[model samples]
Target: MIRLSQDNAKSLLAIHGWSGALLGLLLYAVILTGVIAVFADEIGGWSSPLQHEPATALPKGLGAKLAELSTQVDEQYHDDLFFFPQAGGRIRTFFHKDIVVDGQPSAEGVEFDLDPNTLAVLDRREGISETIQQRNTAGALSAFLVDLHVRLHVPNPWGLLLTGALGLAMMVAAVSGLIVHRHLLRELFTIRCRRQDLLAKRDAHVIAGTWNLPFAFILAFTGSFFSFASTVGIPVVAMVAFGGDQERLIETLVGVSPAEDKTPKPLADLDAMLADAHARVGVEPSFVSIAHYGRADARVNVFTPPSEGHVSSNNLVYDGATGAFMHQKPGLGLVPSAGGVLFDLMGPLHFGNFAGVLSKAIWFALGFAACYVTLTGMLLWATRRAESQAWQRLARATIWVGYGLPLSLAASPIGFFIGRSLGIVELHDSMAIAFLSAAALAGALALSLRDLESLRRVLLAATGAVLLSLPLLRLATGGPGWASAFASGLQAVFSLDLAMLVGGALCVFAARRPNARLAAAARSGIEDNQSQPA
Candidate 1:
């Protein structure tokens, strides 16, 4: 019994330490990416402002432009084509196929270019040029960062598995963190900075962690669900618990695919289909998925945006070839299907994008708080044992990872713009080079710890400068100026630019703090506020 207890105790400690350390930096990255990703559409819109600008109306040859590009891509790539007209503010063309490329099948992605007012391609020549290939959408960077946060951008399964491991670790840390600080509930909202320094540090951690526990828990759980579906076999659980059959199992969990057709005739007029779907759902149609086009019985799935102040499992469907209403399903209810509700809640709850501008702003605030929570937790771990060289080393490492990640990430847009301006043949390669280089430099600086305060000030100043230049960059790239963006209701770019400017100012304020040794010591509860670093 003693041996087993000892083993369990060691295991628990290992879980606490390793999980907190492993996820702390990555969680910070995830929170930052997620907050930015909430406006992915806006960023994408900003990148191609021409698509959303006030035109007299959509150009007359939208169909011709799509058809021309479709033929070129289909002939060249030999794949099924999906054309998203006015998708997230730009037209995107996807070429999909099941074939081995570089010894890997299921290699899928889209080739996109700006929509042309004339029937000509956005670029001079066809075949996916460098500009069209570059993806600098508002949410693109955030999504890429999210990929880093979740799977470190490895292949799909591998990234999911690793992230799942991290999620499990986080679950353990959260539970343990709650236990470690259980006695401090009465002090949750109170911060007494004048108390003993260590008490003050401890107090800050307690307050931030406690007040935001609910939001943190929700984020962790939802993030885990995404990684866990693949790792923990939650889908398998759905299959076994609900029924033995896979298709039926999916249906029970998410929703039944109301009857589909294999030989559906070609859809006639999408305008008619749109009107029919709008009348049924009373919501603007977001996406329309057509299955088995050019057949006798075609199914067109129209998705409705989640309603305000409510989480829904409802999806409205219509027949494409026939223009008939198929079915309407509500997402959450008494005895709601677990799989269904989870599927429905994934986008809204995870990204907080469903509630429009105010909700998204609130979501962004909470996300930043989560980032601070993760940072503070790691700092607490290091400061408690500040005398140890190992602890000091780790503290330096965390500072680099935290501040440096933002620094490198903030430089990516500028990198993209630079690469584009320089006429780089391959945009992704240019972006990769830029991001990796910045990250490497940041990591190197982190290790040196030459002068932590100096580094912090430099990074803050750099971030501030980079953020302040966004609007100017937009104008330089033929995008509208502030007056035009405001007049056209394309405020996403201006809004994002202002947020970055404000964020830069905050960094400046933080940098104004006395100095590094002093900051570290203050954080460690080892120095008097009025005193300088020893």
Candidate 2:
């Protein structure tokens, strides 16, 4: 319905094409990894679940355990405390105070891993938050996937910068694509399959890109905000208003300015507060945080995941001393504002975890479509300029990354299952090594095979083979069998196992298509039996 001048349309088309051409592969990788990460919690549960889930997300008698542990740590460490479950439903409790470590604000604390049922301290570590976090075995595979999607496994500010740039590129492509497709209505339904190969490809890309335009923009904007918030947003705010005191800036945002009242008070029963939180919201909190633990003015924040029919998570406040109900705070800032509400919306929108599995599955499908659009768009662009060496190289890379990434990803779980079963502590290293090794192998396979379709077939087949074996690998490496998983209500394990089998079969099936075409061509003597190079 909207119109642009010819020159404007041409300019937008150029922008749309070039933006995707230049950065499409990386965008595809990010989006694909993001799709995988949608099931991170599920994957974590499937990969490293306990015999069964805890009776409750947060069990009873935790308050007593915390009080007992509190006496062992320094009093200053009681300034803040938080507990959350990870990796097989084990509870991790950290009693810590925020402090500057190497000119960067970091948490220094004593963290204890507790057996959720027995409330027994399984292990304890004390150090800076970042270093201590590295020792955790929680959600090893899921964490790896998230780290790749978030930062591409690169280090800090640089990694954030790279991802943020990709986000901006995606936004540009989405916006320009929307503007340049003048006959958007017709384009959505038109598929010129009987026409030129290139036209058909364009139609496919247009249909997908148009359908996914809104989600593309939403993910890109929110991802950019998340990536830049730590690297650029916070520091700018700190410099402008807080005299560069990052800690103060955080405190201001959290709305926790309190008169220091250090008189020791018996900590309220956390079990009661946790149960109360579930009753209030009809869901268990993701984690519980107590500020100024053991102090008179201590406040507890019960942070819950998204409830049904909600787009954002909730935080319910409680009186730490008496376990009394406090107000539910909606915004991050001390005062409710539009900016805070927008910020709150970002996580649920970008990650699509608001409504749990159903929402995540829809997000996964949309992300897959986005990946298809990105990769196909790149291929189409390269095809138009295939005479040039550079474009040819880009085309080859597009094929490799598009097909080979899943292959590399399939190899990571090999390390995790093997390491966990073998009682090896270096599970993350094992995973990284396995993934990189597969990438190298896939690269070699791509280079050795000049035929792009042939390369894709090989990679996809290999990935399928790996996926097919993963469930068995888990079983071999001490994972529960389907019957056991079912008996114990470990639906995640059973579901993932069935999914892998079906996915593997599909991959193997899809990878055989080119071969079928080749076989028919040979039967008719239309082509030689030997494979041709690209």
Per-candidate total of colliding backbone pairs? 17, 0
lDDT of 1 by residue, 1-534 (tens): 122354555565556666777677776676666666666666655654653453422234543454455455443342344444342244444544445545434434346544534434343222332233334342244445455667776776777886666656666776655654535567577776775555566577667777776777777777777887755575577567856465555565455544655552455555565666566655555554544444455455566576545665246656655767766654532244675577788767877767777778888888777777777778766666566778777777777777777776677666566766676544555556767777787777666656555666666666666667766775786667777777767766677767777887787777666554436553554333233211
The lDDT for every candidate, in the order shown, is 0.60, 0.84
Q: List residue ranges in candidate 1 displaced over 4 A.
A: 1-18, 54-88, 95-143, 231-235, 238-264, 329-339, 515-534
The deviation in Å at residue 92 for candidate 2 is 2.4
Per-residue lDDT of model 2, residues 1-534, tens digit only:
459997887788788889988888888888999999988888888898777766766888888999999999999899999999876677889999999877767899899988787888877888888777666665678888889999999988888888999999999999888888888898889988775445566788889999999999999999999999999999999999999998899998886566888899978888899889889988888898999999898999999986777776889999888889988887578767898788789999998988778889999999999999898888767666665678878878888899889988888998888877778754788889889988898899988997777888999999999999999999998889999988877888989999999999999999988843322322322122122210
Scored against the true structure, residue 400 in model 1 reaches a CA lDDT of 76
TM-score of 2: 0.92
Question: What are the TM-scores, per candidate, against the unseen true structure?
Answer: 0.81, 0.92
> What is the alpha-carbon lDDT of model 2 when measured against the actual structure?
0.84
